[model samples]
Target: MPHSNSKCWDFCAPVAGILFALAFAPFDYSFFALLALAFLFACWQDISAKRAAMRGYLFGLGSFGSGVSWVYISMHDFGGAGALGSSLLTGLFAGFLALFPALAGYLSVKITPINNGALRFILMPVVWILVEYLRGYWVLNGFPWFQIAYSQLETPLAGYIPVCGVYGTGFIAALSASIAVEIFQIAARCDISLLSHYSYRTSLREVHRDGPLKNLPPLIMLLAVLWGAGDLLRNTAWTYPIGEPIRAAMIQGNIAQDQKWRPENKINTLLKYKRMTEQYWDSNVIIWPETAIPAYLDQVNDTFLVPLGNDAKQHKTDLIVSVPVHDADPDKKYNAAITIGKEEGMYRKIHLLPFGEYLPLQPLSGFVLDMVNIKLGNFTPGVINQPLLKAGGYPFVTLICYEDAFGELSAQGLPDAAYLVNVTNDGWFGDSIEPYQHMQMARMRAIETGRFLLRSTNTGMTGIVSPNGEIIAQAPLFQETALTGTIIPMGGMTPYARWGDRPVIGGAVILLLGLIGYRRFFRMAY
Candidate 1:
């Protein structure tokens, strides 16, 4: 049978994961993230690789199960998946994500000795972050939500965002947690006498006599210094303002998902947006939410869009709006955003949302979705390296919907694209924390690119984010409102925008390989 202490950690691991979710938006208990990871690190220490993997799996199951529970809302409330099917699918999805953390735990232990300090302090963080990068970027076309760095946006770790990006910041956060755990573990070893004596006085005396407590202060100080450095760097600006500030407005139509696409509601939707936008025509730029027009480009071009474009040009304002586009090939319709007035351009979405925009795994995904009564779009992805869309006589990157979640994709036009614009329809998730979480990730893009981000969304979280990841202005959820703000076009690039994730990911790869080589060499010498 396992020791009582080990059993206790096993019970606490899942609980810790639940607390970890609270560190993100809608709760904003940021420090809870550090405490939760430290608890997880404690559970993995001195454990067999298999046992560590199981604990990690449990933690992951709890983390994603609570963090992304909104998936059930989107599937059942909107996609028509019945309660039973949606619940099961959500569980299975969380379980699949859990495997990544399990892999991190297994690799951390397998690659280093269980008793080695490096196992807790070095290898653990490296393996954990690398696994996150893999799961966030590669698998299933990427689901980067719940990444730890997004939770640290308001913390000192945010200072590192413009320099190394989200993955690097996450690596530092995990490393900090591991180091704190190591200190606590050392203190625990020193106070082992208390377990037998049942005396608090004896434990204090023993802990001091063991001499580990003397070194504890220095380790604690070192952690403080790291945080201090981040705090100091927070004032550093990586990008500078270019031209004069322009007045911008984001129109949140707050359309009901159930009624948005109805033929009878189409004209009403267009007129509604037109009326709302007419109020902000004095602004230099006006944006409409994703698919606010409720019809294809060809359907509205002649009677509706042309007149709107003419009016925008007459007012000396640029209008950006989203509506589906019909290509010459009937099967190649795209979720696209277009600019009218001042300058004209089009950008089709490059990254399609898995399941929401298109089905994955073909027959299997289609079969399961059909059985669940879930229906989704069959949209096509646009070509890469497309030209930046121009608005108000300046170039900007266009990210339709969740494209802002992918930092690298958002940075592709950077150092050239003056700013970032994201148009999203968040009505599918309906009053859930998903919109808040989405807004959080989108703000990180502004930090990464060192540019103002204009986000227009349907049914909530339409806002403006400044270069340092601060929310400049935000509309209330499920409200029909227009958020107006000013954006200064930024002219330079942050290190993150210039190099992307290469430096941090490369360092991790090299460090892991070096550790493996060192271990093999010592084993052969012995």
Candidate 2:
């Protein structure tokens, strides 16, 4: 390749990354992801494995740096890290995330046969989705934010949410991107002489391979089936309306973090939520954001909890609030969801944030986590496989903060949960896009599970989401507002709720390895 040509590919790499970010919320031109990915694949053409990795990293850098820039705000503004230190840490986190894509790109080019049709249209997508899955499952406790599948919630591919989880949608999205490149490559060699010459030579080299366009029909047919099935699933009521709509109020206390837990401010926090909810007494369900009480469960019980629960019961309304619960280890507590009215049960958050919830490699990371107050740092992870909380005559479960960001973890509650709830305090990220992104991911959880989701947040994005991932009503950012809406309780499980992502991801792995094996076996024998 000419130096100028290579320069063009390098220059366009970050643009692809930035374009990929637009596929996600706040700027959801979901279809742009295909363009970004197809452009990226084109850039990789005739490139060495190392160059592919370099391009992938650059693409990832732009994607994560822009998409998750809110991490810097959360760290510098709220987490208490110094300006320079926070910026560096944020960059490091993004850089680390970029490595997964870098690795995927390198491995993909290396393992995939030379411009093989199957590799372009199928193998690369598997590798990308697998890398994302591994990255989410590996990084500390896990951060499942900003995945490619999360971007496809609007596309027909979203119909696959139940059957394959978000990863399946992502796989299709990636494959589509590759197909775009294949089509373009074919167009570039429009002359039959050029294509025939190239095809005849490549045919001898590739195993189970035909001309790129020749193999394209099956790919298109596969997409048509998956997409049509997704469209069908979109209209299909995997979960049916089970009960009458319930009046729910999401109370945003709007308590400033600095003044949140001061003994002097305890009265203020309690009274703020109390005063706000006093008017919503007629509502069947009232909820508070994560850690709305700003105190330990026992500490609040004497001064507020018991009285609040009794008041809710008296009003014939069900109230759910988030509070820190004292664990056996005093230094480590639980970020617990405790209910106090018509129906009562407790759910502690299972997927803990690495640096935020509990520092990994504590001795080293402890200092960084301590940059800010980290009031809830060192919190314990909730027990896995817990039953859903019952409220308002419907079985539901709560996802604390960004727990809903991971569809698989949230889906664990299954067919038993009729509605989903998310309690978060996005004030930590100020007025950035975090709240909207969080809300977007939460909405995906509802769609994946075939249930409605209620988000109660501190300082914004509090709303009601439908089973189809639509926001019914949402509160304004940084505002002290109560969001009230009626949500139908649904029953029955989507395929995702019953099977999770194992089947989808597992099939990708098997197919990818099988393709590699088939290629290798043919090379050895022939």
Best by lDDT: 1
Which one is best on TM-score?
1
**Candidate 2, residue 190: CA error in Å?**
1.7
Residue-level lDDT of model 2, residues 53-111, one tens digit each, is 99999999988989999989987777666788778888999998888778888977787
TM-scores for all predictions: 0.94, 0.92
lDDT of 1 at 28: 83
Clashes found in each candidate (C-alpha, N, C closer than 3 A): 0, 3
Q: lDDT tens digits, residues 1-526, model 1? A: 2442467878877788899889999888989999998887777777888888898899998889999999999898888889999999999999999888889878887887646674448888888889989988888899898888999999998998988899999998988898898787667766655455445555655655555566677778878877887787789999998899989999999889999988999888999999999999999999999999888999999999989999999999999989999999998999999999877889999999999889889989999999999989999999999999988667999999989999999999988989999999889888788898999999999999999999999998999999999997989988899999999988998889999998999999999988888678757877
| Clashing residue pairs, backbone N/CA/C < 3 A, model 2 | 79-372, 80-371, 80-372
lDDT of each: 0.88, 0.81
Mark the regions of model 2 whose C-alpha exceeds 4 Å error after superposition: 1-5, 192-226, 367-376
Off by over 4 Å in 1: 1-5, 192-218
Looking at candidate 1, the ten consecutive residues that score lowest on lDDT are 193-202
